[model samples]
Target chain A: MTLTKQKNQLPVFKKMSTQPWSLLAPLLIVLLGLFLYPIIEVIRYSFTNLRFGRIEYAYTLHSFKSVFTDRNFLDMVRITFTFVIFSVTFQLINGFIVAFAIYIGEKLKLKGSVFVRTSVIISMAIPGIIIGVIWRMMLDESPTGILNYYLSLFGFGPVRFLTDPKIALISVIIANIWRGTANNMILLYAGLKTIPESILEAADVDGAGSFRKVFSIIIPSISPVLMICGLLSIIGTFNTFDMIMSLTGGGPAGATEVLALSSYKEIFVNYSLGKGSAIAAIILLINIIMAMIYFNMNKKVEV
Target chain B: MKNKKTRGKKVLIYAIYILTAIFFLFPLFWTLCLSMKTVPELFQVPPKILPKTIHFNNYIHIIKNTLVLKYLKNTFVLVGATAFGTLLISIPAAYAFSRNKFRIKNNMMFGLLIFQMISPLVIAIPLYSYLAKLGLLNNYLILIMIYIALRVPFTTWYITGYMNTIPKELDQAAKVDGCSRIRIIMSIIMPVCVPGIISSIIINAMSAWSQFIIPFILVDKGEKLPLSVGIINLQSTSEAITTHYLAAACMISVIPMVLLYIIFQKFIVSTISGSVKG
Candidate 1:
């Protein structure tokens, strides 16, 4: 019926298309110039041997080869996996713990839950760089450092947080977890609300223990939210280098240099655009894999 | 017996809630303490939670000694323009997407989803060279344009979702009354969409204000940097500013955003949670 009407009013339909296209013109042009063109350029540059100093370049596989063969390449790959996995795991756990606490608190008619709710999100308001600085200060091993100072009160001396290669990645992960927990909390808190109170009450009537309800019912019900938080956390941690730059600068001998930071240092600091673009291409591939997982997860959930 | 058990659970829950609140709030509290102490106090063997004497001078010191004032000015213009430009560029496209049956609409929407997944870091290398090649490096306009490009996909997707709720009959009525498409948007659709648009602006502004990498990579001059980059730049200066001064600077960059979050707590909380809800 709609097709017949459109055929009868072909002039109106034609005019409609014209207006929509015109309205879409600005977005289209901007996307081409900034988003699409640059993306194509990144992939293009990944296949070239362009450096900052030299103008002439060849479309060879030198960049990919160099990036893959660099002594630190496998190290970076390991660091990236470690960073993404640990950050996602701990962030989700912290988020769920805080969110569940809030849920239980609200159920119990506790007034302190409001404070917990407000406090959990405060760090999210902070920029990643600031969070890095604050946490660096917190984890500062100096005599004046707050955490260590308290540790001394308990007979523990300062621990090397950022200096030790063994400990530096752990510190970065902690800062990232702090930077990321609020997002997890928000997403999972929203998820928790979707489980009807009636369901919990029924469980209570059935003599279901708290652990059982949380493990069996609550987990299954919010599986989609957990999946979202997982995918988003993975992709987000994979791309971000700001906090890491501030906290570690991929430092104490490249101990904390994730792929994003490595690509950044390659292009800007090292002045090799091709290698950076190659690293970026790899990052993009990882992102696309995650995106594929994201799509498949959404499809599964919908089914 | 049931009542006794329930009360014990209640006590445990409150204990967790209070402890969690402190755990989350500790870093900011420590920063505040650090920002207020004198330079010597920062290095004192036992760090004092409350300073010997609170100094507001660190805030004064940064403005007097650093490029913080200039950075603040640059950020206001850069972030303000990016938010305005994003809304301006995305809203029309969102309206068009929602109202019309176009050949490329589905494809365009899907493309936007893919683009949104590609972080700005992934494209920054090429963007740097591309902008540099055009002799547009360090130009504020290019940065703003880049931010708008980065922000448009999500904003368009958000506003399109918003526009779908406005009944099309209103557009039909306005058409019968001979109102043009643009005029109807400005008068009819926009007014109704103001709440959604405000949420979009707040979200966009938050992200833009926090942006470090893009601006850090593009704008080379200290005088032109945003707070996220500016404060870090100051932290790395050779003169070796004290921890207290650095803390003050971090606090300076953070306070406004926290204040904005506090003010828009309800709107932000609901919008973020609701945006991702099934």
Candidate 2:
């Protein structure tokens, strides 16, 4: 009907119809110049052999070959996987549980539900960088560190949270979990609310227990939200640079080194633009693939 | 028996809720506590839960000595420019995308989503060399421009969602009354979407203020560095006397955003959930 109406009105509105294109032009120009052009430049740079000024300025797959063959490449990949996977897992579970609490609190008209909601929202607003700074300080391997100080109360000695390689990656993951849970909570709670009340009520009338209702009704209903949230958590954690940079600097013998940081180091710290761009290209490829899956799932959810 | 079981379950839920809230909020409280502690108190064995004497001087010292104020100024400048630039650029684009029946509209919209997917780090190297060759490094304008580009797509996507909510009849009526599209967008749609616009501004401003990677790479000068980088340098800026001052500076930097979050809590949650839904 709208299409027929639009067709009928096209002759009369042709003059005014051009206005939208004009309005879209500015955003189109800015994005092309800054975002799109830079991406094209990055891809082109990745294939070339341009160092900070040591010959070999030719277009070849040398940088890509070297990146795949580099000794630390596999280790960086492993670290990146461990960080991304575990952080997303922990973040999703914690976020879901907290969101469930908020959902229940609202359902029961609990008094402090508002306060709990406010705290979660505020936590979401706290910058990742500040989260890094505060957690770094808290996880300091000294008695002064808050976590250590608390642990000492339980008869544990000071633990090297960031310095001990075994614990450093976990430490960053903990900080990320801290940074990410609120986001998880908000999305999951919103997801929970979207579950049809009739379905839930139907389950209740059939004598479904809480766990059964959750597994049978709630989980299936919110699975799309879960998928989107999980994917976002993974993507966000994978792109993590600020928090990791501050928290670990990818140190303790590079135990915390992730792809983004490796890209950062290769470009800025080492000034090897070719290798850095190559790493960035790979990170971009992974992100794009993950995002494609996310959007695919999202499309299904919307439908 | 059922009543007792339900009450016990409620109690358990509340317990978990309170514990999670405490876990989420402890960092903010801890930062505040540590900011008020003396160096001796900071290093005290087992650490003091509360300071015997509040060291207000830590806040005063960082403000007086370090580049804390300069960092604030630079950050405010970047945030202000990016927010304004984004609004100026995105509002029109959102207006067009939402109100118009242009060809390639769906493709452009999908492109915006793809743009959001790409991380800034992916293009960091090329952007660095490009800006460096242009002599734009270490400048607030370069960082702001990049930030505006980084945020504009999401902001535009957000505003477009808001614009789609306004009934098309208003635009139709305005157009019949011979009002131009721009005027309709400004006079009609803009007022209705004020809450969304404010949320967009607040969210973008906070993200811009907290942004690290762009400023970290783009700006090399000490004076030009934003708080995100400067606060990290607090440790290296002073070897032995770092902890209290770092805490103090961090508290100062974070309080504004916390305050904004408190004031705009409803809008923030709604905006996020809206984006997630999309």
Candidate 3:
């Protein structure tokens, strides 16, 4: 009788297993066909001497060697690292500060808090490309440019915001910070909201000052959110392409060229398909490594 | 004495708040002012903080010259098509993962997560080459396909988290009521999951509409370009840097998205917060 019952349960288990596969099969097929296949093809192409005409017929490490040895490759690597580090740091600091201000405003029932928060939210809604264009137009060095025009009134001369190589990277960084910081603020704000009011009140009752409360309670409470936000900002800043493309075009002597822009120019503009793919693969590797290191270090934090 | 101190602090807080608000909003305010000036007047020795005359004609000129309607139409179609397509595929997959434990489930989910983290730019070159080979370059269908592929992992993860929150008892009861799997999904599961679905749709739609890099690299033809690309092209090709026209274009390009955000601001903001917290 026991054997019979166990035998009957086998069919049910089999049916349950089959059901998921039935639903998942089509999705798996599409992912394999559309996403995986092309990625594999790119990996294959990266090992070859594939170029404009012989893309289908060549296979070698010639392109990889060329990419590694290219004079500008190291510069590109340095620029990418610098961009990611600076952008993520600034974005995190600014994001947390603004989020703290908003949270305090909410607690105190400050006037115009709602308006300020909403406007910040609206900034996230604007597309990056549009923000880039708007900044580019505003920072035009001509006396009539909005930024220059304002400066002149204060008895200052027009500044070469985009044209000056020294400032071009900074200009792109500002546009990026403007477009991106809101998302982080929203995330951090949400994290703040999740912290119970009682805990804060308890701290206040204990005579904990604002700075003490923030350091002792708030930071520890929101550390997980900060980790996630930091990881996301790192990934985002590393992968950023659109703003850089629009604002600087990696111009003024390639002053603003990041990995994404470099790979793009190589693949599309120069038609060095193999080298481009190699650069792309390297970027992919860097992201994966950093993400792995992050997860390993903070294994207890849940996504 | 305590009340007076509180009042003094409140005043100080208000002063700081107003100053910060002005500083944060300067760019938008500056853009608004510049939108009202003609090209020549835009370049005056002192920048026009406020325009003397409102150049409503700038909007008309920009609209006429840039084919703004076509760009808008393209954006709508691309966003709608991709959003719908992503949801249709992702929902079932999410359900399967969340509700059904089966062979290779863990591996598949892991794969999806890894793919979600991969940057689209890394795949752009290969995808472009493959699409070019297939003669599918510049086609809207390809864009839709690529967007769906790129977005599926995140959408699936999002929907699965939501699906997991719903009780399994409901599904069991629906199954007992002679509901087929398909019917149960459509009738029982989807209705209860509207909030998640809406969040997914809005988030994906925003990304799709705002997407620039993929479309920039993929599509070559001007007529096929979306608003993001189209606006850039317009600004670049214009004979002179017409601040008014650029601002007008910027304003027009921003309106639809801003309107959407306004309409769904509460849901969008809450959903974003929820997603981050989760």
Candidate 1 lDDT tens digits, B112-137: 76677887887678878877878777
Better of 1 and 3 by lDDT: 1
* TM-score for chain A in each prediction: 0.91, 0.92, 0.88
Write down the worst ten-residue block by lDDT for model 2 chain B. Answer: B233-242
lDDT of 2 by residue, A109-228 (tens): 777888887886777677777888889878878657788878888998678898898789999999899888877888888889887788888887999998898788887888888888
Question: Per-prediction DockQ scores?
Answer: 0.56, 0.57, 0.48
**RMSD from true fold, candidate 1:** 3.3
Ranking by lDDT: 2, 1, 3
Candidate 2: TM-score? 0.95
Clashing pairs in 1: none
TM-score per model (chain B) = 0.95, 0.95, 0.91
Q: Model 3 in CAPRI terms: which quality?
A: acceptable
TM-scores of the candidates are 0.94, 0.95, 0.92
Error of 3 at B61 (Å): 1.0
Question: Which structure is stronger by TM-score: 1 or 2?
Answer: 2
lDDT string, candidate 2, B1-278, tens digits: 78886787689789987898788788888888888988788778767667787668899999988888999999899989998999999999988877677677767877787788888887667888877878989976667788999998889988987887777766777887899777988899899999989989998998898888888888888889888988877755557457878889989889888898899888888877873553
